[model samples]
Target: MTVYRPPARKRLTQDERRAVYERCNGHCAYCGFELETMHQLHVDHVIPMEFYELYEVEGYDLDSMDNFLPACCSCNIYKHTYRLEKFRAAIERMPDVLQRDAATFRHAVRFGMVEIKQHPVVFYFEATGVDVPSLHWDAEIEKKYRTGEQK
Candidate 1:
């Protein structure tokens, strides 16, 4: 039996990493959070490598300096392999999701401990007009899917 393996990802050189870090001036491209330490930063692929097959069709470099962004750990973890617009949509739905799922969140809103503001989901890169690719690699999900755990 052949075991499925994800496509190999390229490791960025020190210079490459530096360039990505400076892309957003040491801030997260998604949330604009200042990253004080390099270790706290994650180099994100604008167009994730998981969609390697789309690179040719999309006419964008799948792996290159032009396709990288500087992201804080929180933003990177949250983005988590979603297309840019999809991530924005997910963020836009946060209030509703919280209200429906989190009792504490709903109680906080009721008591004025939390306020849900209405606004478009505008990312830092988008606000600054810095181009960032919208881009999922989910290993556990893939495994579950292959095993018929996911419908």
Candidate 2:
């Protein structure tokens, strides 16, 4: 099978990147981790650009900033080319996936070393009531994330 390589992504300038960063108040949109440095942050595409090539969708600008969501390095890497919903579903299934594939995780759970919190996968952006489709970020909105508020 021939692999289709998507075109290069447009690079955002510092100001543009700052805007994206501020979208989640310097937090990962998926995991809600406070991003410390620019190098550690990733602007993930809410709808992967690969979808445009896969489905041959025309007139849809997948590269537009409207599809951008600030993410930490891990979240961006894990999310990969999955669309938002698929990514969410994958996150929801991670415990099952880990329990099946990772002996360490399974052992930890079995021995009461790890406690799995079963709940729907809610992205940070979703929890913050951010308008994801429009890519709107309300900087004024306060976030009570697990890691605690930003100092």
Q: What's the TM for model 2? A: 0.78
Error of 1 at 58 (Å): 5.9
Against the reference, the lDDT scores of all candidates come to 0.76, 0.78
True lDDT of residue 79, candidate 1: 78
Candidate 1, which segments miss by more than 4 Å at Cα? 1-6, 57-59, 133-151
How do the predictions measure up, each by TM-score? 0.79, 0.78
As a TM-score, model 1 comes out at: 0.79
Query: Candidate 2's residue-wise lDDT over 1-151, tens digit each?
Result: 9988777898989888888888898889999999998777798888787765632333345676777889999899999988677888999999989989999999999899999998998889889977665332212122323446653
What range of 10 consecutive residues in model 1 has the weakest lDDT sum? 132-141
* Whole-model lDDT, model 1: 0.76
Which lDDT value does model 1 have at 32?
94
Clashes of each: 1, 0
Give the Å error, residue 19, model 1: 0.6
